[model samples]
Target: MGDGRRGSIWSIPEGQGRGSRPAYSRAQITGAAIRIADADGLDAASMRRIAADLGTGAMSLYRYVPSRDDLIELMIDHVLLEADVPERPTGDWRADLTLIAENTRRMWLRHPWLAGLQRPRATFGPNRMRLLEFAFGALDVGFPIDEIFILLDMLNGYVERVVRGEIEWAREMRQSGMTPQRWMTESAPYVRELLGTGRYPMFERIVMDARLPHMSAEEQFRYGLDRVLDCIAAARP
Candidate 1:
């Protein structure tokens, strides 16, 4: 990526961040933008497309959200709001966080376009801010606010990484005209050769037991949540 587009696309424009309240609210425009993103991926979600969805001229949207980057940020926050978090303390902390993580994964799965958009631009909309606060409030840990933020950030980062991998795998499958299993089958010979060596007995056992229940995204999310809860328990006074 060229420096100009790289810097501009991933980061919000300076001065654009502190927008005065306008006649047209950002939430309304952001709602329209998110619909566009949901129906079509980010590349197809142009300013003109969003404007059409909002029944406004493209230039009119600029009054609320100046650049495409701002629209992308709004769209992410809007879709994130689609995630349904349970009421606090209704379940164990591990189960509660697992639910949040799985819901987050489902949100990305529903809106694959979300995986492609740059998150650095999404500083925080009301919905996301509330969600973050809810996460912290639900946790039993005694960490400082900054540490809580870092933990939530790490969780979000891990979920995003998983979604991105799924999206990339889907894209590659479409381009290659082969299923992921087929691709793996074709490469299995080399993998087997490496595993067949006596040095990798554990690796061989793990690979040979392919029938062992592989973790789904939901399972993986729950496992990670359990580990986090363990850490939080250890950190308690």
Candidate 2:
């Protein structure tokens, strides 16, 4: 007979039945998977690979994780533990949101594979639920639930978009020895020629006057986050 925990990984408890003891914990399997994924990527953390890391046969892991999709769901939620979210929102919406944003960015950067996941089904793991509460509660001050949803989505969208670019750029640098400085140096002549054409006044302005293009990635993120928070503030009644 099945335990009846079919669809969602969260529906199944870790050590449910009465037994001597389970040989492996979900955390152990998830941790091994995360380490492999961190080093190689999501696909490399296959059942066989993870089991090999744990010094067991691949079939043994299914007794714990059940399936590859379940394993991935576990892996995604496991790393959310690194976000270091508080038990609840701090009541200062800007500070709370900023904390969430920064922590989320750091988490995604550390686990760049996170930016590649396309799981449309919502997996409400413990850590994910905690962060969700913090985010929604922070924005729950006076706005309607729909607006709160949009605002949170906007904030998360901005953070994810920026981090995705950063991750790709880092990968490019690793694969091809590319860097921002080298890119600028190589593109300088074409940029100069374009500027001399005076055909792109806005591009000229960006080239001649923009400070954001020159800021460090961290600085750029902070500056943009501040602008996003300002917009959120403006939305308040």
Candidate 3:
């Protein structure tokens, strides 16, 4: 991610050392940029917009942050710190993983813009590395490091996909002024017709007989997590 000369943006100071006194700090610029991204999203968090927020020229921002990509890397690492991973693994591997996954899910939902960022090939920033360490350490089971990495990837991928879908649906609901109840009411006729055709028997049976209302969102999430963990346990050699 860095060419050594420019180095990781974290190594750079927030202020121009040549100056008598640096007014704006890197933390200020990064915080402003994060607010912009949080409010409007990654596309809205440009150098120009961030500069406007900081009351400086966009080009001057380069003195503190190297590039937009670098800024985003900073943002990602910054937010990852919010995840309160356990100080040590709970020793129960499945319990530890479930706690970690739930923490991760809450983090994504907290920063809705994160799902939309065009992240680079992960550069292993400080907090990112901390997260990896926590995940690996939590796997108290005797799996090798390589397989542990794969398990982390699978869990991360699942959370990413699930949270993105959840965010997208919420965004659409807000933009379209359509509540789930309203959507069900509006689409009831079409949905009923489709189901009546018996094209999907199992889906219809579940809708009618499985008592989905009893399954809350958290329950649904845990159900999937438990199944995935079960599979992971089975995969152990």
Candidate 4:
């Protein structure tokens, strides 16, 4: 969220550069690629589709992006740069973490494909490094750099785990030709029937709560962040 810099480990290789400018200078191409991923999911966002959107041949884009993986990484980081992380939240770590979590949730919602595109193998893009620096800075908790990285990775892994579950559920629902709500409805009768045996009244009572499943990711993110921070606080002398 800071001023643009070559923060990515995957900066275009020298051969791929065009006299200092990136071989591809058109923001339109990148924007179209992002849109394709957003509208149809990352799998639908091929280099060919992006080129078609730009009215160019797919081969031409190769000068800019050597591979589909690069394009996907760039797309994800580009959209990440668009997220608004407010000024540092002073020393209030709780409020700062909440802001970070909400910003992350909003970014994921804006580009659902991002949750799918990211992988453990992918190198740290510049935007990602900035975000990491941001998280550490906001924490301002005096943890060692390695611990900070581990903590951030844990937080990130948790969010991605949740998002990936949602993505898979959405994909399965689409494949089954049923909305999630419909699938839930169809399963409810069987579930209620199972509960009628009286072996799980506590579970039934929990399920009956009006607020179940209504909590937003932002809320969950904040809840998890605070819980982890509380643990850290407790561990302190």
* TM-scores, each model vs. reference: 0.74, 0.94, 0.86, 0.74
**Model 3 bad stretches (over 4 Å):** 1-7, 11-17, 118-121, 211-214
Off by over 4 Å in 2: 1-6, 17-20, 119-121
Write candidate 3's Cα lDDT for 1-237 as tens digits. 222355567666557457567667777887898899889888898989999998989877776777766888888888888777766777888887888888888888888988776532485677778777778998747889889989888887877777787788789888998765687689888878989898999868866788544576567677778878898889777
Q: What's the lDDT for candidate 3?
A: 0.78
> Taking the candidates one at a time, how many backbone clashes does each contain?
0, 0, 0, 2
What is the full ranking by TM-score, best candidate first?
2, 3, 1, 4
lDDT of 1: 0.68
> How many angstroms is residue 110 displaced in model 1 relative to the true structure, after the best TM-score fit?
1.3
Worst ten in a row by lDDT for model 1: 1-10
Best of the two (2, 4) by lDDT: 2
For model 2, residues 60-163, the per-residue Cα lDDT tens digits are: 67778877778878888888888787888888999999998898899899999887786323678988888788789989889999999998889888998999
Model 2 lDDT vs. the true structure?
Answer: 0.87
Task: Tell me the lDDT of candidate 4.
Answer: 0.67
Better model by lDDT, 1 or 4? 1
Q: List where candidate 1 sits over 4 angstroms from the true fold.
A: 1-28, 86-91, 120-122, 209-217
lDDT (tens digit, per residue) of candidate 4 on 155-218 = 6676667666666766777688776567778898888887899898887876687453556544
